[model samples]
Target: MNGILSMPGRSAESLVDVPHTLEPPARSTLPPSAQRSLKALRLSAGFWFLIALVGQWLFAWYIAMVYARPVLSGTPEAINNTAKITGYIVGDGLGNSLLISHVLAGGLISMLGLLQLWPWLRRRVPGLHRWNGRLFLALGMLGALSGLYLTWIRGSRLSDLGAIGISINGILILIAAVLAWVHARNRNLGQHRQWAIRAFLLVNGVWMFRLGLTAWLLLNQGPNGNTAKLDGPFDLAWSVGCYLVPIALAELYFRAESSRSPTRQWLSAGALGASSLLMALGVFGAWLMLWRPHL
Candidate 1:
């Protein structure tokens, strides 16, 4: 009887010792399915981000292409010829400088923004990422300030509202970017990641806004005569939707870090997947509209 009792204790001791005897698997030993799933998720996010980045670049390119000749030509006739019938001008020299700065900054931001989507670039080249981020922030600030200054000079109500909306978003982006850098300096990586994500989303606001416009026009079968008129209702709707959606998505991702429940995981994954899809649709749709022209 004593031997039997001792045997149970011995067995328990042996079980505890067994774990100690074996080495924990290195990261290389992570299950294949888990690794693959991680890879898939990253690839999906990268793919969607690239789509958004490219779409934004193309739009910027189109704007530059349309305005470059006129702005660079520096002739009175060219200066007076606005991109749109209702477009506003900021006189000659200042307007030309603003236009040139806007296009160049936009192009650089779009290109650098694409590189930031890659995980390796973010992790391995953090110094480069940080420098680029600073440049982007500075340019974004310049763009926003310039945009606000030009908003008062916009010819149409819709254009004015668009400028204001973009300016507000640009400010938000700058704030987020600043916060991200601050958090990173303090070593609060979670907050840094969240703020960085928010900044990136704000940077993509133009893409989202353009898509919203195209959808509105398409659903209406064509633009109404007063479509260029910025009504409070349209401006409010666009501002709320574009700003809230991505922030909400980023929050969902942040929350997923602490959640262990399968349901929460499902919800997080669903939100991420949905956001990725929306981003892709917005990007591709905008590209088709801008580039194809007939669409």
Candidate 2:
């Protein structure tokens, strides 16, 4: 981030975009049949994105139903929606809209994840890639802004310390998004890649929240004790842990990739692989124990 540090933060025009030409993948020059098969296997360009987006849209649809039904029908009971915790949250048309927007947009943000992670797509379709990158940054900023308002002003039931953690979470997300844009503009792909990954993980911090909190509930034999609702210092701890740990892990991965040591690379690969598996397990844990039941 020395490059980022040296660049003036005050001016949006400070970063000069030095166009860098990246070499096209060898797979692109392969025989037509071979290249075609790669797409079928989702190894070529961005074809797998269709599969990923389908899953995300389905998830979004479910969330839309979960939250929207209560608000639309003017249902007095909280029903399956967590937003129904306090009647006041959904009482105002503003809070109701924000909750619905946040839930619906969550899956779309996951779609942006597909773009940032896939390098081939950007090479194949630079125009679409540039447009979507801008869209991703815009929506990401909006999501964080609205989330802060909903969490703090509109009352998300977070404890004072938990709320502070959440506020910091939003700020980090916003900062990461801005930094990604700056680096990308400067053609600093190295810095851009790292900052983009950071932003991606930070954007998905809520998933960590669900996964961590749900696992705690399961281990403690239901939502008994401080785990029941967001109470005590546990929420505060988990709120920060969810994002902070991932950010630390991202930095570790960046450093290992930059290093020349094969041993370090191997260790970093193993650790990241294990972390991905754990994250998948956490998703399942949350789905089985929390969100699915709400449906």
Candidate 3:
């Protein structure tokens, strides 16, 4: 009764103004592995995007001039230039059409893929995200299919192992795309994100090829300095390593994030840091020795 009548001397306003006990909001926490993974990703995302931008533009520029000028103005350098294309340019008919479609769409696809991973854009402009996602998926499938055809049916300059490696990459891209779509359909955004990243890396595997080749050349002292041509030891190594290695490391990161092992966290952090530095070097090598001269 005394407790019930405690406000008897107080005005209604004073009673209502009394502070009430409420538990503070729970503090969000991430495991150490996850924290390191996120930090590494954040630190590298911008640099990765810059490298990707260079890659897309370089591809687009080389394709347009090499293919278009030859057809439009009868330029023979087109042949010489396109001979440098990793998969080798398909001169005419269906192959050319597919390759051209990929060339024209590749940059847009990459840009949209990057944008789709943006949380703010996804929340603020969901329609744009959905449309871009569809376009990215469509272009990615077409590009990978054409690449597979070129590598297998049209004859690649690499060894049989390299061709097989490329085919495996193509298959992986298809699998990643399908998994991403399924996850999106099931409303599992987290799984969708993982699969989408896998697909993005697969789609950009050519960047690694370009970067690796340039790094090889630079290390060996430029074009004639290196005995490795289209099918060298380094090329052979990177053919499978480019896609597979990245995927493996990504999976390792996800495992660490889930398990939250401190040892794994340190290992992942060290690996990611070193890899990012190497990637920057790759970009620089590719730019200085390979694409820059052409531009």
Candidate 4:
């Protein structure tokens, strides 16, 4: 597989791992205007990752304090009172185990994934990156499976539409996970990294859903198009958009980075910057309103 997929003369890792590498074109070949556009796009992407890293770490911390702590302290039932989702069952040991595993695995994955994408880590600590990437793919598959079981077999969703949305997200996660592994096994690191990114976004659909929902609620001064069942128009759209929008933005970033056209690069940078700003707003709202109160 490696021989078939890898380039004959290329032994170095993919450029995807080292976006800020002092490569030849970046240092000398590209025109000043194109270089500037590339730099802006890189900056915007860095800003987005910075925001995501902080927000997701905070969320992981929140999960640790609110969800994992209680389970560890031998009072798992307490989670029922604290969790925003229907996370605990009073008597069902199997269900409770799955719930705890899903939540904790999610928190760990969110924390670990940011490190996997760090340019310094991948460039300098290649072994750690490879090991961590393996662990991430495994956990991602497990998380997706557990989530699907909870939403469908366990009937944890608020509405049938919401369940359908969750199912789609789970399926995407599985597909991304498989493709990422295949690419990695084939030594196609560039495609592997892209699929890994898609997997990360899909795996965090629930997290993004919370952030997007809180942002919308704050912007509207209330849950204007929301209901107790979460089957409203905005909720339905948001369930899909939470993951899709970020993936679309990532695709734009990839295209812009590869394109020599300064206009396309600048436009992609603008789109990414705008989306990052909105994500920042969402993170802020989620931190203040949802996660903070629980913590």
Error of 2 at 130 (Å): 2.1
Candidate 4 lDDT over 74-178, as tens digits, reads 988878876556778778888888889998999899789877776656767799999999898899899999998888888788899866776899999999999
Tens digits of per-residue lDDT for model 2 on 1-295?
Answer: 1222244542211121212332223445656654443222222112222333333444455565666566568772454345434333435788767656765567567556556554545666788777777877777777888889887787775465666776788899899999999999998887787777678768777767777776666667666435445655667787888888878866665554444444554565555555555555555566676566677
Give residue 153's lDDT in candidate 2 (0 to 100): 81
lDDT of 1 at 214: 61
> What is the TM-score of each predicted model, taking all chains together?
0.71, 0.71, 0.73, 0.91
After TM-score superposition, what is the CA distance of residue 205 in candidate 2 from its true location, in Å?
0.8
Question: Scored by Cα lDDT, where does model 3 land?
Answer: 0.61
lDDT tens digits, residue span 1-295, model 1: 1221234433211211011122223325556644444333334444445556557667666655555555566542452343443342456567556656755666666666655444445666788877876777677667655555555554323555545666678678768878977887887765666676677777667657767656555555666432445444665567546876777866665554333333554566566676666666656666666545521
Over all chains combined, what TM-score does candidate 3 have?
A: 0.73
The lDDT per prediction is 0.57, 0.60, 0.61, 0.81
Candidate 3 residue-wise lDDT, 151-222, digit = tens: 666654355755676777778888898898898888877688778778977877876777766766666676
Error of 2 at 121 (Å): 1.4
Quick one: best TM-score, which candidate? 4
Instruction: Assess candidate 2 and give its lDDT.
Output: 0.60
Give the Å shift of residue 243 in candidate 1: 2.3
Clashing pairs in 3: none
Total clashing pairs in model 3: 0
If candidate 1 were superposed on the true structure by all CA atoms, what would the RMSD be?
Answer: 13.9
